[model samples]
Target chain A: MTGPGQMLRRPLNPYLAALVSAVVLIGTLALAIEQRAAILRDGREILLKTEPVDPRDLMRGDYVRLGYTDLSSIDETLVTGPWPDRDTTIPVWLTLAPGEDGAFVARSASFSRPETVAAEEVVLKSLPVRVTVAQPSGGLNAIGRLEFGIERYYVPEGEGLEIEKAQNQGRTTVAVRISPDGAPQIARLMIDGETLYEEPLY
Target chain B: MLRRYLSRELDQWTRSGLLAPGQAQVLLADHDRRYTGFSLSAVLAVLAAVLFGAAVIALIAANWEVIPRATRVIALLILLMAGLAAAAVAVRRGAPWVAEAALVFTLLCYGAGIALVAQMYHLSGDETGFMLTWAVGALVVSFAFASAMAAAGAGLLGFGYLLAVQDLFSGSGTNPQDLSSYATVLALAFAVGVAAWRSRSAIAGHLSALLLISWVMWVIFETTELEPGYVLAALGAVAFGAGSFTPSPLTGTISRHGAVSAYGAVMLLSGLGLIQVSLVDPGLGVEMALAAFILVVSVAVLAVAGGENRLVRRFAYFAFACETLYVVGETLGSLLGSFGFLFLGGVALAVMAFAVTKIEKRFKKGEARP
Candidate 1:
């Protein structure tokens, strides 16, 4: 420990250490960049959001206040069973017909697959959106690691900083996609999403 | 023709005598049995583990409350013990899956307890008990198993606890009375955490840092009540001290988080202190001494910022910048302040040049550290 400063770094290597360090640093940087990119890409989810639910999480603070994409104008009658409430993050199958808005209105939702639908049932991804610590109060709107049939929750930093803040502050707003069957899947958080700070009433 | 052809082939094979099928067939069968048996079982074992994992999650969610609090705690401890046993068995028997399963369950249970508390208490301001429990439990598990994840979790839990209890530390009135006491507690916490860190236990550093930082901030916030000026004086010294210890991430980070507030307060207090000194208030000598001490700290900070650590240098540079800004703003605000601006500007520019030159020197030195 030449200067007491060297004491900290004595455990690491010397000559090839920089190369190893660079790899480690770059790998971490890439992940961070990827996380930020994910939030930036899906920024539009802010506009599509509809429902708000509170989830008690430690990393992201006390609750997961969230909203979902609004399908208010979609058909309500074709729906089947209850949606995932505060209970589960289960898959909710749905079939939607093209509405006047050009968006597929959800025709039905169920735990089991629908046998037939007048309109083609487009299989949509139901993801559990979470407020990552890195981008607390924001979302990395990227095409997640999993494209469909999976939810993506990002870890903001090596240790969750922003998420902890939000959890402590109760400012992290997460959005979930609720199928007509009442089953809910996490969509995205309101952290970086273009939405107001408040929880959506619906 | 068929008889002749068969006879010729039979004669050739009999002559070769190397066309025996039974030995090769038996060897192939034995190999198949060896490879297929283990591979199939491995696949099945993984599938079974996944199913069990799913069931564990389901059970926790379904009967979250049916399992008593005490039972969950005991189960977590048992699971941790089981995980260690499994790891040991795996190491001994060469069965990696067994150990992996045990570890996963222990980790999950350790994490789940905190989540359960948050759920049980509705996780509002009133959920302090839950936070404390999670933090403590996580700390125990982390140290017991030397698990980094658990330690980090504990650290986060500790931070959450401080935030939840900020009211107690925030203090009331204008005097920051509890600083010395709070600092002592933080120091003790840091000592314990360091021991844990040295042991390579999870969450030790995190927990230690979380406590230390929150305590420092709380102390600053609390102490500001007595005389907001002391915070700047103390924090500025540390920031400068940080600059002195360049290329250290710990020091760098500490300076940023701790000294940022200190620097802000320094500028405000220094300007105000200068004005008070000029006025010659009866007890102004004490204030003047404090101001001089602060100036020494700033000079030290400049020297430290001369180091290679980006965080340290940035903070030191920011401190200097803030100091200059404070002098300029304060002088402009006061009638005589304008007259001293020229002198201050010269000193500030000189400091900046010195810092720039040190940058090259610092980088060269940095290249040598391991």
Candidate 2:
């Protein structure tokens, strides 16, 4: 399309390129903020019992790792479907209802989504995880453990160890906000029924 | 870069009488008019932008409790917007180097914002997820700006993501998201590769290649169920085969200058060497076979693309030297001891020197004829 005297190729319009760059970056920030805000505003609140653990993140600061008691293991008795023989990671649908102690616990776990959600029940989607079910006599009933992504509670610097100590004493609880899509985010950390830290959605 | 190439060619043309001296100066002037030569100040401006970006990330990590979270988030967004707006102005003013640097700064701000926001909100996802998000954002900026620097940024981000994934998987329990993480890393690599090709950035392309190779190595290292050496050797073979035989689509639209094939050959040879080292009770025959394979591939690479591809030539030379020494040690060491091995190595080097001289002559003759 060009003679030897002309340029080899047409250059992209710099103005348009710059404009698109700005818009893309702005859109990314907006999307992140919007998602967090929506979860903070409209998600349902649920309290989870936590055990003791601690870790540090360079960028996210210090944190106490939260492992829920009931959610830790969906025992072979809790699994509602046929367990596969080979080791595998699969998505689990957990049906949650208030337990005798007033803390939400897994009522039924299934490979497929439950067909119904009762008015008082909440079904949360768990991240795909390796099901450590022992294939004993029959495959009809198998119990295993599953961990959702809501595990860590990031606290301010030098505060993680105290929370971990409280958690070890069975005095720590996590307040989570479950979005409509079954995604749960840690909303607050409570020890001995006193609110120690409340996460702000920025 | 274009100016350097044109000036060299112009000198030859003027000396050969293909261009009058007056005409040569006119052509040189015209080229100079169209292209901006390298400027130290412009480089400093970009360097400053990078430093600024790093400072912003460091500031976020510092966790300034004095500033409210809402204010920090708003400030980050505003900084990103301001950087982009300045870039747009630079573009309109016909300063592309400045614009690219500004875009890089903006992408950095966006990444810092993501990390800080995640920290503020107590998001519990792994570092892999954070890096993937950052890489994707950098890739978006790269594509939108058509900036090779931004493309290089994307490539670097993808590499960081792979390293994070390796860290995430190196711990005790099996990673349930292993497959997904690998897929995401590969996809990120491909995206950066695309950006590199689009921008004709060789450095970015090479970085993408490094990411792919590292991902394969990490996967092989994580699961010992599969032999790392054989898997890497097979992967290298496939990559080299695709790069050498399948021309158009396999090579994509990039002018790689046989770089992919060169990288594949390095992987192949390195894997074979690893196998030889890991062989516990191998007979002399197996060791001899590995030595032969390494020698043949290195020689073939040197012969085929040695003149055109500098990377291939250098790696080939190094591999050939190492394989020769290894073979010598295995065979002659037991008989003649270490001194004899050194003597044989010296002789082998002489032979290599002779062969290199002959090849150089042939290449020069071929160039002269053409």
Query: Which predicted model would earn the best DockQ?
Result: 2
Q: What is the C-alpha lDDT of each candidate?
A: 0.44, 0.76
What lDDT tens digits, residue by residue, belong to model 2 across residues A121-146? Answer: 88788766555444555444433445
Candidate DockQ scores, in order: 0.01, 0.32
Per-residue lDDT tens digits for candidate 2, residues B1-370, read 6777888998999999999888878998987776563577778888889999999998887667778888988898889988877887887888878987897788889889888877777666557667777788788767766677888988988988888766645532344467778788888888888888776678888888888888777767765567678877778776666655656765563344476667777777788778888999899998899889889988886776676667777788888989998898888889988888889999998998898789778867866886
Give candidate 2 regions above 4 Å deviation: A1-12, A54-61, A73-76, A116-120, A132-147, A200-202, B1-19, B23-43, B160-187, B209-257, B260-264, B278-280, B334-343
* Candidate 2 to truth, TM: 0.82
Which candidate ranks first by lDDT, i.e. highest?
Answer: 2
User: Once superposed on the true structure, which residue ranges of model 1 sit more than 4 Å away at CA?
Assistant: A1-202, B1-108, B114-126, B168-188, B200-207, B216-224, B235-299, B304-311, B322-359, B362-370
lDDT of 2 at A19: 65
